[model samples]
Target: MNTTTLTGLELRPLAVPADVSELETPAGHDFATMMDVRNRVYFEISGHHDESMSAAELLPHYQPNPDEIRFMWVAILDGEFVGRAGIDIPLEEGSKTAFWQIELLRKSWGKGVGSAAYELLENKAREHGRTVLQSWASHPAADGVEQIEPPTGFGSIPDDHAAHFYKRHGYSLEQVERNSAFDLRGSFEIVERLLAEATAAAEGYRVVQWEPPTAEEYVAGYAWMKSRMSTDAPSADLEFDEEVWDAERIARHDALWTDAHQFVLVTAAQHIATGELCAFNELVVGKDRAEASHQEDTLVLKEHRGHKLGMLVKCAGLVKWRELVPHSPRVLTYNAEENRPMLDINEAIGFTPIAYGGAWKKVLE
Candidate 1:
């Protein structure tokens, strides 16, 4: 792709080997400067840390090969990183399309830097074999209802401008899931109560915990959980290929745990009613800081919903966490503002709301 200027900006992918040294500078060196652009454009605009931007977390989703998962585009003005976008090709089941996630520095908005980045990405997608593109576009708080619009050629929107931007592009709404998250440090008590209530509601069904009989024993359970999850959870448009995530992937997670952290779950005979407490947590260790785990991917089966299994298994996990990791600080989570059921349980626990927003996806067709 040739370099092009849009509204006085240059947009391109960070060339590795050449840019690695530049991008890897210490956080103190240029961390906040680079992070501020991303946090404001992506996080702050979406009701996340609306005031002060936190340090950059792990590179959104890191894969061994950049070509396999994400294509990052950045816009520079006077040599300063001002805007950026990411094309996440999540190799998960049922997600059939490539989507775009766009972010803009506060000062960079209103200029065409975002548009330039989009055009470059769109062209790159066409070069690679991406036919249909999809994005989860958010409406401004003023717009109210969540809408997914069709992708035009180039141009993306921040969460707030998702509805208007996509509508302008020509995409149609395929799905909308109200995502939710919760902090789990001591929040397990509430999850336990919810589990009890759900179990009580599920009269004939029994919830049991199963530890892998052997390291290999998890294949069946993992497959069962994956298939059952495919049936129950919200459709994130992930395309299920040859089980890209398996025991090996799970074991990698197991490695991240201290003796205190273990994967636990509550399940019916063949179905996982609720329990992904350990799976969703994204644990990362920084240079100077201790490891932090983000509790995510909490889900209960559809038929198991009314029984309050959601709360129960979560609580069960929390109790286990407390017993095991007594020295940890707060566990963290983030949910789309609309997911109320989990929100209900989270509030019941002591997980005070921290950040709220939507994840945007744009497809190139």
Candidate 2:
């Protein structure tokens, strides 16, 4: 696809380095400058205290992966970076959707830069055979809704801000999600109590914690449980497909995190008699920012319901994360509004609403 041109502005692919050390090269310099622009806009719009990705933190994303292809582009005017955009295409069979996103500096928002960049992104997605494009935008709760104050260091945008933007671009809101966070330093007693109850309820299941490069014995079972996330998680009315995962794919995912120096803390509940993995949860902490961690996935197999295994694994994982990354103060997670079970668990454990976001989709003819 050819690059798009808009009055003194040009949209071109931005080259990211494979190795963190090579960021000083000419191509890498452009990449770094582009990220700086993105970070500035993100922080300004979200009002979040989270720091932008460092060179080391950003290198792994550029690494080649067989399962997905990513394209990054920069919008430049008069030799200055004005905005950036990206499109991610999944190579898995039956997956015909591309995730697209574009961000422009606050000062450049009213201009034609965003439109030009998005046009280029759409062309690229179509060239790759994607028939549907999806994107997510965050905003505060709408009027007449109970307003929940976000936790310290977090922020939310006005509800109409992103809604109007996407609507103008032909995307429809499919689902709304509540962004929640747990201040790890607030209170450990509730988590301790939940842990005790879950432990008693899950009598025959034992919890196992491990770092990345998951154990060989649990690799197959782990992959199986991970694959279920796509089908098990609530997607509301959005059109989505289940993902296929195997032992090989799991290993490849582990390598991506390892190369980026990120830490993955996993806790799984194993059925004592059957020796089968039934439930699991994961906590991820970027090496550059140990002050905050992300709650990735927490799923309990169908047969394991009512055992409180979800709470068990989550509590165990959080405790393990504290031991591994003691400096981390908060953990962030997002859950669909209709997912009451998980929401109940999170609320009981002290997670509060931080923001709201909508998943938007556009089907191309």
Candidate 3:
């Protein structure tokens, strides 16, 4: 069925085809255009195409997932696709929080198109019984732009266009996340030195590494660590449901990366005696080996802190990642500004801050 598009300023749910190959069919037309606008919009904001992805690379995420229900829409202003919005509703029991995003070309701002699309998203969230809504947007540091700091008192982000919009819509800045990048082409002397220190500090743990489809003996431990990401990470006021993961969820997660033709490396810390996986770090690169690599999730369980596992896993991941994808120029990662421990590790590994993103939230009646 054709997606419902209203007049010139239409904001309608994107109708995706069963597969990316269906892009040739009318069914995939909206999906293709949305991906295009998404890419251009990001590049315009960051001046880097690191976040760009082909529709095929993003389709699996838009597909139905048992854990998160996705609602995506495209905005057409005067018969041209100019923007897109999405909401991901986590299926935890009694969930009242939904994470959403609204992206549009800079030229489309102040046209009321974003407001229209937001109404579409807010209405859907209310329909799903959601009470709290959260979203994030990169706020590039500008020389004269005012800045807003979260109550957590860690990092501050420019109160630029996105911040103004969020304030106008009743959302409060709860946290700021730092977007950091490590120069892979630079020397790894610091990384190797820190790895040795972390290794010595983590006396009872050893580094274990793998790709997708986690090994049989490590599935349970890996799944448990993955679940803790929802709670173990620092979030001052942003709401997140405690996710439960198992072998099936791991398989599904692995399949998403594999199907997208992306290479992923998982470096984890295992307890020497109990064989428990205490920490993990992930590095991912798209089909093009030369493109920027992404540092996905790096977590050290709360009970396992103070052992420098965070640094151990991170340095280990980067050390191996260079050998895995020798040509990838750089690695990018994000962490809450309040997460000083992780930020400290990244800084010691030669990561430099490139941008800051604001985490905003609003509550509905």
Candidate 4:
């Protein structure tokens, strides 16, 4: 699809082929520029300087995945790239939703570029048989707004921000999330104390740690715990499906991480009597920029609740991650506004709220 704004700018999908070889040709240059624009827009909006993803880090996301169909496009005005947009459509029959994103340089705002880009994305989503379209936008907390109360499906930000942008486009707020950060360079005494306490509380459960390419013996169990994350985690009002996982899927994910030069530290709680993996958490550090890491998935199986295993696995994983990447300055994580348990653990470990964002959804009629 092609869209022309009133200012004579055009929006269209990138001409790069779906093959990996494009990364080495002239298309590679455009891809890099596109990533730069995305990074700039993200930082400008989120006010988080250290969290931007580098080109190497974003490569895996652009690479084709068997279970997901991705589309990337750019908006050009006067022969200059001004905006980028994309959608990720799950190939599963049960999932009729698409996750979409649109990022434009600051200069392009107030123009019709974003609207045109979003319209194209909506058309693509409908063309793919998607019934629901979801997008997320980050907003920095106002000055002196230290402790933000959980959102109530509404925001107080000005109408020009992302929250209002989605609202104006007919999307309803489904859930709110807080982006928090834990300074890894700070004293480890708190983490150690939490670990000791959790270890004592979660009796009969031993902690196991591993890096990429999970051991042959634990692959199936690891995949099982990973699968539970989707169903067990608090998703608020969003429609989601229980992710299907297996040993092969785990291997494929690990390969992607390896190719992205990400160092993954996974720690899980193994029940002693049953020999079952009951809980697990993952911490991934990007090799390209070691100053920051991301807290991925942390899940405790339904049958194992109230064992303090969540704290146990998270603490163990953080410790191992710091050991592997001592120079990493901080770790970032996101949790639903209603997820008190995870938030409690995060706060107790010195993670402070950095920003707030919400999941916006629109049901296409």
Candidate number with greatest TM-score: 3
Q: Which ten residues in a row have the lowest lDDT in candidate 4?
A: 147-156
lDDT of 1 by residue, 212-282 (tens): 22245445445445445444554444322333446665554333232223333322222344432212112
- In model 4, residue pairs whose N, Cα or C atoms come closer than 3 Å (at least 3 residues apart or on different chains), thus clashing, are none
Q: Which stretches of candidate 1 lie over 4 Å from their true place?
A: 15-36, 40-43, 46-60, 65-67, 90-96, 137-160, 173-192, 199-220, 223-231, 236-244, 252-293, 301-308, 322-365
Q: Which ten contiguous residues of candidate 1 have the minimum total lDDT?
A: 276-285
- RMSD of each predicted structure: 7.1, 4.1, 1.7, 2.7
Candidate 3 lDDT over 59-80, as tens digits, reads: 8777779998998888888888
lDDT of each: 0.49, 0.80, 0.91, 0.81
> Predicted candidate 2: what Cα RMSD to the true structure?
4.1
Q: Which stretches of candidate 2 lie over 4 Å from their true place?
A: 140-159
TM-score of 4: 0.92
* C-alpha-based local distance difference test score of model 4: 0.81
Give a tens-digit lDDT track for model 2, residues 1-365.
43546677877787878687778888688777887887787676668756466666777777777888999888887678887888998887878889988887877776777778778878888898888899876675567643322222122334375566777888876666778899877768889899999999999999988888988998988999988898888775565657788989999878778888888888999999998999999888787555578898889988888999989999888777777788888998988777789999999888998877777788988
- For candidate 2, what is the TM-score? 0.91
> Which of the predicted structures, 2 or 3, would earn the higher lDDT when compared with the native?
3
Per-candidate total of colliding backbone pairs? 30, 0, 0, 0
In Å, residue 268's CA in model 3 sits off its true spot by 0.4
**Candidate 2: Cα lDDT at 81:** 88
